[model samples]
Target: MNTDIILTCAVTGAGDTPPKNPNVPVTPRAIADDCVAAARAGASIAHVHVRDPETGAHRHDTAYFAEIVDRVRDSDTDIVLNFTAGGGGDLIPELIGTADDDRQIRAAAGSDLQTPSERHAPIGELLPEICTLDCGSLNFGNAVYLNTADWLREHAALVRDAGVKPELECFDLGHVWFARQLIDEGLIAGDPLFQLCLGIPWGAEADPATLLAMRDKLPVNAHWAAFAIGRMQMPMVAQAMIAGGHCRVGLEDNLYLSRGVKADNAELVAKAVDIIQALGGDVATPAATRETLGLRGAP
Candidate 1:
C-alpha cells in the first residue's frame, strides 16, 4: 500500500448541485475560502471548477478563474491548486432541433461545446500548479462528454506549454489507454499524474475490481489518485488507499458526510484524513504532494 498519499478536495464541480446542498461554493470568493479551509483540514490539494456567480451555472471564463486564483494565492493557506480544464465538453442532444443536419446537432440549448484553446485559456492564463486533462469522451449521463483523442492531444500540448501539470482524469480503461499514448507521443512531460474518476453514470462502475483494473494499466512512475461519487465516496477512500493509490474527496464528488448529513468541502476532507489515519497511512502535506507529483510547487 502507498502509505504516503496526496489528498485532494474538489471544491465545487460544474454540475447543478448547488440547489441540493446550500454549502456548495458558487462564487469565486466562496470557492477560494473553501479551498483554504480544506487545506487547513489536511487536504494537500484543491481541485477547482468555477461557476457563474449569479446563475450558478458552470463556466470557462478566464475572468472567473483569475479571481479565484488571485484569492487563493493571496491567502495564507498553502494548498496546491488544481484547476478544471475539463469543462465546456457537455453536449446536450435533447435540446437540438430535428432538422437532420450538423447545425441541428450543434444547436442545442444546453450544448456547451468549446474548442481546445477555449478550454485551456483559463489554466494557461492563471497558471495553476495542476489542471485536469479529461482523457477521453464517454456517455456522461444523458449527454456526451466530447473529449476526442485529437482534442486531448491539443489540450495536453497546451497544458505542457503553460507549465502546468495535467491531472489526467480517466473514467474508463480506454481513457487510460489514450493517456498512455499521449505520454508516448511526448505531449505529456515527466511522470504522468492521473485521477481515476469512478461512479459517474455510463462510466466505470465504482467497484473495487474496476478500480484495480484501471490502476494496473497506469504507466510506471505515474502518480495517481482515485475517487467515486455519491455514497461510495468514503468507501472508495479506503479502497484507493488500500490499493496503493492516492485519494480525492470533497463536495465535487459527494454531498453527504453521512446518510443524511450534508457536508461542506472541509468536512469531507477531514473525514478522508480520518480514514487514512485509521488505515495507518499518513496524508501528504502540500509541499510533500508537490514534490511527489513534480508540480512547480504551491501557487
Candidate 2:
C-alpha cells in the first residue's frame, strides 16, 4: 500500500448522470464550485468534464473549459486540475439500425465523434496540469468507446506539445498493455500516470485479484491510481490503497453514499479522505501531488 496517497476527485464527468441527481453540477460555474469544494475537502486533484448547462450533455467546446479553468484558478483553493481529452469518441450503433452488418460500422444520431486533433483542442488551449488519454477502445456497455492506436498517437503528440501530463485511463488489461507501448514509443512525457478504471461492464472486474494483476503490469517508474464504479466505489478506496495505489472518488463514478442516499463531490472526497486516514495512509496535498506527478503549471 502507498503510505503517501493522492486523492483525486473527478468532480463532473461526461456520464449520463445529471437526471439522477440535482447536485451533479451541470454548469461550468457549478462544476468549478464543486471542484474547489472537493479540494478543500482534501482532494489533491480535480478531474473535470464540461457539460451543456441546458441539456446536461457532454460538450467539447473550449469556451466551457475556459470558463471552468478560469473559475478554478480564480478560487482560493489550490487544487491540481486534470481536464478530460477523452470526449468525442462515443459510438452508439442502435440508432443506426439493428441490422447485423450495420451495427459495427455506422454511428447513431447522438454519437459524438471527432478527430484526434479536435479532441485535443481544449487541452491545447487551456493547458491544465493534466488531461486524460484513454489508451484503447473497448465495449463501454452497449456503446463502443473508440480510442484507436493511430488516434492515441496523435493525441499523445498534442499532449506532449502542450506540456500537459497525461493520466492514462486504462479500463482493461489490454488497455494497460497498450499504455506501456505508448511509453515505449516515447509519445508520453515524463513518468507515465495511470488511472486503472475497474468494474465497468465488459471491462476489468473490480476484484482484489484483478486489481493486483493490473497493478503488476504497470511500468517500474509509472505512477498509478485505481477506482471502481457504482456500489464498490468506497470499498475500492481501501482496496486500492491496500494494493499500493492511489484513490479517486466523486459523483462521476458513483452517485450514492449509501443505497438510497445521494452524494455530491465534496462529500465523496471527504469520505475518501476518512477512508485513507483510517487505513493509516495520509492524503497528499496538491503541492505534494504536483511534485509527485511532475505536473506543469496552469497556462
Candidate 3:
C-alpha cells in the first residue's frame, strides 16, 4: 500500500565520515543548517549524531544536542528532531598481547561508552520529539555495538516516562525480536516507530529478499523506515518505499552523490526527495509526520 512517506535525514553518523568527506558538518550551527535545509527538501525528521568540532570525533554531549535543537526550533523550519541515544556501551575486549595480557583502553572509532543514565541525559533534558533506541547489541561492522537487555529495558522506560518516542533501531533480525519483547513488556509506549537498519557489516545485508523479510516481521501497528549503507543507499530509498515503509538518507549513510562526487546532508535529502516524487509518493511535513506517528507537540 502506497502512503505518504516521511523522509529522514541522518545528518552526521558516528563514524570516520568527516575526513572522508569535507562536506560533513562538524559544528552545531552547520548541523542545524543542514537539518533545516533537509526539512525544506521534504524531510520531516532529522536524525542527528553529534561530533567534536576540533577533532571531528563523535561525542554524546547533551550541550551539543541542546544547541542543535535550539537552533532548529528557533528557525522557521518545522522539522522534528530525533536525537540519537544509541551511543555508548560499546565494549571491544582487549587483545593486548598473549591471551592472558588482554587489557584494552580504547577501541577504534567513536565509542562514547556512556552509561544508561548518561545515554538518557540528552533525551531527558533536550527532549527531542524522538530519539533512537538501538534494540539489541550486535557487531556494528568490526566493532561490537553493545546494549544489554537490562540496559535496554531501563532506557526504554526512561524514554517512555519522558514522553519521547523511541525509534527502534534494529541492526539484525534478533534486534527486531528484542524490540517486540520491549513492546510486550510495556516498556515502549504507544505505537512504536522502527528504523530497519540494512547493509551494515556484521548485521543484516543489503538484499531485497532480506529487506522484505524484515519488513514482514514488523509488529502490528508499528511504523518503520529503512536505509542501506554505502553504494546501495540510493537504491534502498526506492526499495523502502516499495516495501511499504518510509525512508532515511544522508551523508552519514553515504558520502558520494555519485562516483567521485562528494555530497552533504542537504544534497542527499534533495536526491531522496526527487526519487520519492518520481515514484509518485508525496513527502510528509513535520506536522503531518507528527500526526501520523502520534508525536507530542514540542513547546
Candidate 4:
C-alpha cells in the first residue's frame, strides 16, 4: 500500500451538471474559489474545466481560462493547477434521410469537435503546470469522445514544448498501450503522469480488478492516479491508495456526499483526505506532488 498520496480535486467538468447540483460552479470566480477551497482542504492539484457562465455549457474560450488562472494565482492558495485540454472532442452522430432518400451520417447538435492546436490553445496560452491529454477515445455516454492516435501525438508534442506535464488520461487498456507508445516515441517529456478514468459508461468498469488491470499496464516510471464516478467515487479512493496509486475526487466525478446529500468541491476533497488518513496514508502537499510527478511547479 502506498502511504504518501497525491489527491487531486477536479473542480468542475464539461458536463451538463450545474442544474442537477447547484454547487457545480458555473462562473469563473466560483470555479477559482472552489479550487482555492479544495487546496485548503488538502488537495494537491485542481483539475479545471470552464463553462459558459450564462448557459452552463462547456466552452473553449481562452478568456474564461485566463480569468480562472488569474483568480487562482492571485489567491493565497498554493495548489498545482491542471487545466483541461480534453475539450472540443465530443462527437454525437446522427443518421438522416436526404431529399433524395439517401441516408448520411452528420454531427448532431451536441458534437463539438476541434483540431489538436485548437484544443490545446488554452494550455498553450495560459501555461498551466499540468494539462490533460486524453490518451484515446471511447464511447462517452450517448456521444463518442474522439481522440485519434494522430491527434494525441500532436497534442502530446504541444504540451511537451510548452513545458507542461500532460496527465495521460487512459479510459481503457488500449489507451494505456498507446500512452506507453507515446513515451517510447519520446513524445512525452520526463516521467509520464497517468490518470485511470473509470466508471464512465462503455469505458472501463468501476471495480478493484479492473483498476488493478489498468494500473498494471502503466510504465514503471509513471506517476499514476485513479477515480470512479458516482457512488463508487469514495470507494475507489481507498482502493487506489491500497493498490499503490494516487486518486482524484470532486463534483466533476461525483455530486453526492452520501446517498442523496449533494457535495461541493471542497467537501469531496475533504472526504477523500479523511479516507486517505483512515487508510494510514498521508496526503501529499502541492510541492511534494510537483516533485513526485516532475511538474513545472505553479504557473
Q: TM-scores for all candidates?
A: 0.96, 0.96, 0.95, 0.97
lDDT of 1 by residue, 60-148 (tens): 88888888778887997889989999998999776355555743445368879899999999988788899999999999898999998
- lDDT of prediction 2: 0.92
Better of 1 and 4 by lDDT: 4
- Local distance difference test, each candidate: 0.92, 0.92, 0.88, 0.94
Q: lDDT rank, highest first?
A: 4, 1, 2, 3
Measured by TM-score, the strongest candidate is 4
**7-86 in candidate 2: lDDT tens per residue?**
99998799889889988999999999999999999999999999999999999989998998889889878999899999
TM-score of candidate 2 versus the correct structure, residues matched by position:
0.96
TM-score-wise, the better of 1 and 4 is 4
Model 3: lDDT to the true structure: 0.88
Residue-by-residue lDDT tens digits, candidate 3, 154-250: 9999999999999999989999999999999999999989999998988899989988888888987989999999889989999999889999999
Q: Candidate 4 residues 254-278, lDDT tens each?
A: 9999998999999999999999999
Clashing pairs in 2: none
lDDT: worst 10-residue window of model 4: 290-299
2 against 3, candidate with superior TM-score:
2
